[model samples]
Target: MLLSKAGVTAMLGLATLYTLLPLTWLLLSSTKSREDLFGTNGFALGGETHLAANLSHLFAADGGVYVRWLINTVLYAGVGALLASVFGVAAGYAFDKLTFPGKERLFSLVLLGVMVPGTAMAIPLYLLAAKAGLVNTFWGVFIPGLVFPFGVYLARVFSASYVPDEVLEAARMDGASEFRTFCRIAFPMIAPGFVTIFLFQFTQIWNSFFLPLVMLSDQDLYPVNLGLYVWYSSALTQGHPEDYLLAVVGSLVAVAPLIAVFLMLQRFWKSGMTAGAVK
Candidate 1:
């Protein structure tokens, strides 16, 4: 009943190509002018290249709004992911190692949180942020992303699998305080898990569309996705397709940071996943 190795290889090859197709289109589309983008075959090279000009207009548009959006995206994704990883790892460690009343029930609630659609919480989160006078502010978007239940769950999986009770007990047996043991011994052990969690949260917040759209009215507070949406919407309304072309180029530019992060940090994720799997 087992599949042949060639079948498996073919299946994997198809999956890889499927994943890369859209990205390939994005790269090609970004190099094209609006007229060419609309008229040309989707996968073909353009009649005339305009990547440099398009990027110039994308950056200079609306008084350099794209630059602001890029910076906002960095702050939102970077800081939110870091805090979410810290909280996730700490909560996960506690869940796996510590004895507490109603621990299972609490974790059930966390699982429920993980299952809840983020879109469903937008209004409620907006209301809460409004109540706290945080609406239209950086914190409104940043705060919601810091509590990632799925990240906590992932961390728990990593903790239970990667970290051993014996190592913790050995640290304790050496008269190491609980905090010191966790900081020195456990944190390094879970470093790969944290990187994985960080990338997850980073990608989530970076590509988030509706939550930031609901929470922040100011264009200055926008992540790249929302900012691009605004441009695309403006193009649709104004009957100018140039903005549409700009959005395509901007999308390509926005993804560069994520590609860089993966290129730099993928080693940690690969090693961590391998260790976790083998252990």
Candidate 2:
């Protein structure tokens, strides 16, 4: 038993090291100047920290384009995730509670969407967006981001677990309209579920790369991830080591929102997952 415990502890230690080493390198690298970034060991700090200078360059580079990208990311991820969560939760609620024609078939389709990779759908979505004259526009990326099949799946499960049919029926019995009941009763009951879906979709849309790459042609519309990619790609060929530094600093900044969101909503996320597990 002692040997088994030691082995498991060792394995966990290795896993944690694997996960944090890259992030540790990124944090250390973000503080280094362009020369020291490439010169010093990745895990070591530079002789002089350049985080402030790197941040200034990052925001001021290319006529302050990185700021635009960051704003665009916030708009896309924030608005898109909120709308997607609402839509997903509503659809999940309908699936769990209300019955209509072809309901099972439609849910099967939603499940199929969960199985389909987002990259696979990106081309088709682009074609559709192009037909609608939305290509290269904010709506092009924003609209596609609102469709989160996994969130819908999670919502359905959460709805079934978190919300009770008895409570819904009582709401209806009390002369509440379907929409009213949902908004007042079911939604509150599923608040944790909503937070879970929101966080998941927010992270997904924030880190999204391919769909935007396909849909958007304008740099002004690029999200931070896409913007960093452009800078990093240019750096490799253009001999602009400063661009690499900007990319590294931008990466560290980009991770901040996800960390903040997870920290804020982690308790809700945990409760939502476990709340439905028991009777």
In terms of TM-score, which candidate is strongest? 2
Q: Write the per-residue lDDT of candidate 1 for residues 140-230, one digit (tens) a residue.
A: 9999989999988988887887889999999899999978987898887788889989998999889899999998889888999999998
Q: Please report, in order, the local distance difference test score of every candidate based on alpha carbons.
A: 0.89, 0.90
What RMSD value applies to candidate 2? 1.7
TM-scores, all candidates, are 0.92, 0.95
Model 2 regions more than 4 Å off: 47-49, 271-279
Scored by Cα lDDT, where does model 2 land?
Answer: 0.90
**TM accuracy, model 1:** 0.92
State in Å the error of residue 83, model 1: 0.8
